[model samples]
Target: MTFTFTVLIYMGEMWKGGPDTVGTLHKLTIKAEPGSVVTCRSAVTIWCEGTMNAEICVLHKEESQKTWGTQTPEMPENKAKFSIPSVTQEHGGQYHCYCYSSAGWSERSDTLEIVVTGIYYKKPHLTALPSPVISPGGNITLKCISWVGYDKLILTKEDQKFLSSMNSQYIHSIRQYQAYFFIASMTQDHIGTFQCYGYYNDTPQLWSVPSDHLKIYISGLSKKPSLLTHQGHILDPGKSLTLQCCSDINYDRFLLYKVGEDNLTEHGNQQTKTGFSLSNFTLDSVSSSTGGQYRCYGAYNLSSEWSASSDPLDILIAGQLPFSPSLSMKPNSTVHSGDNVTLLCQSTNKVDTFILSKEGAAQQPQQLKSKFQVWDFQAEFSMSAVTTALSGTYRCYGSWDSSLYLLTQASDPVELTVSGEVTLHDYKTLHSTAPHLENQDHTLENLIRMGMAVMILIVIGILIFEGWWSQRQDKKSTSHRVPEHGK
Candidate 1:
């Protein structure tokens, strides 16, 4: 590239200002990495001194040893700058500016040490502490990997600020220079490149270009997995409530879904979190139509993929078909006094015990004596003494081999009231209250039946007598006629 060398020049006598302070090298270093930019700077006071044809001067630049890797900035007149492109380790050599004038070249300036300082951290890379690429929804630890022995590390990402880190001295002593950078809860922000750097206290140097980029990633929730109820809750229509989906923070995004026979629909809101409780803060309000098993998920947000699922969680509300266990007596609502009554609690679930309880009774609830009855899918509780005190309210609670469903909250409450027995005076006073049976005309009907039987017997007796008289007359007449014929 053709460029003008613009520099300020002054002669000792001919110009107003004369003597220029000598040039001194301030900061000089040699450094470069594969496919990277290398730069050098210096502090050398230059002045013009030469014959008429061509004025002469010398330029100084930062250097570690005796070599020149980059050229200094353009100067106006006497000062001269020398530069070579793509300077490599082979470019190392002693260098200084020489002026070609009638007086010949000037004395050489002080030598600046030039030595390239790099390649210590061979193939710098990053690694997570736990071997697994994916994370579970809990606590975890991580480490930024580097070539053994490489120190002075700077961890950074494309759009994020750099976060400094250090390798353990113990690790270095054990040849484990790879630094461990801990994050309480692994999150999406941890994804990026981590590099190792070395200072240039001895060479033509600056920070070596960062080592090859290393990528950090967080796995999806499903990568770990969990189990949940298929039909979460049988929520009453229009009841105001919310469902929660949770996981660890290792994934980029999260999802909530309702698994169906044919398809899956979003059950609640989808949110993003950067902290440890990956799923603790994620939840959505419950809707009237929300029903079915739902589970949380950690999204990969990858170019060619889907989110991972977590261990499923099942929620079920009261009144669901496999009902939450409803307790009711044989004759619910109302029953005749002194009737043998049987109470039962039934559910489409497995239960270990069924508790029978009654309110408005003579005794305190828990202290009140109760019974636990068991059956295949239910329990039967019986009480023979039917009293007004016994007539308050009754309910049954079921328990699974494990887990408490807040028996009182999950089960329904039943109301019971008993009536007194009937009596003669009471019945006469409130005859209208009684439903009449067909026994009212029994005696009169019996009398009528007797009279009809007696009359029928008398008529049959008279008919037999008449028939005997007629037969006797006929026999006599026939006998008399036979006797006359014989005479």
Candidate 2:
């Protein structure tokens, strides 16, 4: 059966700035990443080299402005980097650097102009060079990719300003824009979420949308800690769970890290015996957000170092339902185009909403409230005049208001087989029975295969159109040009 699906868009929001300084100009140099053009909602890095006794301060100035504003963190070092997470149109401007030492403030360095590009365009793509995880003292790289033409690309770590640089392999292909950042000697401080952005070469202030987030996980420690959950990794709502961290070697403190979260929960001053120490953090009532991967670390008070992280534990909250919901089709037989169909989602527990999802669709599940009240909660989704797209394997989920966006465990899948001609698999013979595939269900698998075929065709069409457009533009430009009298 043929099938088509709509695309689903996730909701979110974004925004832009410049610089001034006074004092003699120093012989310092300031550098900008991705060749000075960037996109909004993308990260950008400005760096300056410094002396041992001098405190480096990054300064920025807007176009046609004399005064410069300072960006931090001003530290005494040999070099400094100032990063902007999500550069907006306002961030387009000229940037320079100055060094402040006991003698006095040094002169401003050569100013680098940053132009914003694709201010109203989509975000670029970001990916790790080799792998997401980095061992201590190892090197790693991140690459930013854009289809639209952009000159500059910026990389940021979490929300903190970080060092940014571009590699020689910038923009390897004309069909897409690309940049790379090589981070050498990774450490625990480098562990955080990262994102990239692109900017137009001419319009330094305007930025493109942000690339997808990339997280850097740091590893390599002396010994690994142990992670223990109060009961099991899975639990129901309103239940308590204690996550404990223990270390075999001597340690005074323990830390628990929730993957994707920025901060680590610390526990200290716990009682210990026989060179073993343990600390636990408890959740009084579990929620949807509480479910995720977690790891523990052991630390010593004497040294500011942490032991290797424990094996990650996957935690899941089953909502407040005692069991999963049930899903079924009304006809319970072979279906075809132009037929009317109803999908029933039933659960024993009361739920605020029921979501019906077709497997392998590029869209979010369709949600509906329980229209009819009954002992066994049931929600009916009616599809009038069904089309070929409506034939697929589907599942239902029960959810409550307290859980907000989280869904309970999924119900068993119901398959809707569609054929152009009717056969023995009609309602009379298959009534009261759920549709099943022979050994394996191809409803979802077929849909996915069809979707991939469509996507490939679209991509091929776009390449052909782009080649034709480029030639057409060249011809038009040649025709409009005026010949020089001398030539």
Candidate 3:
């Protein structure tokens, strides 16, 4: 005997069951094993999970009408596994699955997109709009561009957790096809390396080669690190420069970022004698392109968050302009303390400003507006009551207002010598005289004593002469009187 089973229709599918309402079956879920993104010729599995009493499952591709079915016991009793031995470009697309049981066919699962990479040879170019360094609650835009005219672009993060796609737009100005992905309110989770891929609309899952990696760094997450350079910020072309990034938080890594630059220079942290963590970045034979505002950040190895940015350091490239300035000190380079001094920086060419820099100074160079003098453009920096602290080797540079970071060649260095205070003793000793007033007083006292001795000797001589004359006269009278008495 032969038995016939009546089939009922629901949601455009034939199933063997009693009369039941459509769209009332339990929903099923579908997911890709490993990941939805697969490399060429790699193995992958599509899982469909539902009720344990499910007898059969059907997997359907959204792009095509192809359907795959799995019987019970071949997979687990509760789920169905549709395995692909070697995935190719044709196997990549949107997919859904349905499971059939006593309750009838389950609702179609949500769509899952399977991407196949490394299908094309040309790769897209990815870049950040302003820079990769971002602060918390900030926004950044990532641009993906290509010449191949792909219709779609996909951006993927390093951890495989973030995936986004956008339709490409033709940019006639740049003659390229591009797409912009804007990330808003950046947080610690947004800090990571990223890459992009390009694909056509017809083959959404088939992608070209991946673009070069672009790293995104989030700042203001921890304490900032200090940036320092032993070499002065103003440097001649072809000079070697080394910048140090230091922090006291024991960070494991350091990142050096130049403003208006897309790439960051990274280095491992080294412990210093003061128990501070630091990293040194060196640039050999630097040219004009090396000059810019720079900042540094510190980060730990295990965490993606970076510390706050260090203070900006502006690097000026010298000898890029046409003319240099001359530096001179008024009233001789050597001056006494408390004397007002003036440093004159003069340039033959018309300059918008003058920069005066002292050697080994940690502060920024002093800038002054240039004034048209009798013969040239000059700026005078007058220092009143100059002290020894102000004495140092100074050089001047000329720069235009438009290009403040680019400067002319350095002028000849002028040395300033500030002598100590000059006392009255010092003035007398310099003229080869007695250093003290007491010696002059002693000489005047000796002259007065000699004059008094001379006066005393003359009075004694006059008295002796008077006494001798008186005695002679008296003896003569006595002699005359005695002779008369005898007659």
Best by lDDT: 3
Global CA lDDT of candidate 3, please?
Answer: 0.82
Which residue pairs of candidate 3 clash? Answer: none
Worst 10 residues of 1 by lDDT: 10-19
TM-score of each candidate?
0.26, 0.38, 0.67
Candidate 1 local lDDT, 326-393, one digit each (tens)? 77777665665555577777765666655555643323222122244464476677756454445676
**lDDT: which is higher, 1 or 3?**
3
Please tell me which predicted candidate would have the highest TM-score against the true structure.
3
What lDDT tens digits, residue by residue, belong to model 3 across residues 1-487?
1111222133234333321332447777788988888888889899888655776677777645435555442445487889998988888888877766777667778888899998987899899977898888899999999988888999999778888999999989989999999999998888888999999887888999899889998876699999998888888888999999999899999999998777899999999899999999998787988888999999999977788899999888889997789999998899876678899999989899898999988877888999998889999988776666667999999899888889998999999988886433334333343355546544545655887888898899889988998999999999989978999
**Local distance difference test, candidate 1:** 0.44
TM-score of 3: 0.67
lDDT against true structure, model 2: 0.66
User: Each candidate's root-mean-square deviation in Å?
Assistant: 23.5, 34.3, 13.9
Model 3: number of clashes?
0
Q: How many angstroms is residue 475 displaced in model 3 relative to the true structure, after the best TM-score fit?
A: 45
| TM-score (C-alpha, index-matched) for candidate 1 | 0.26
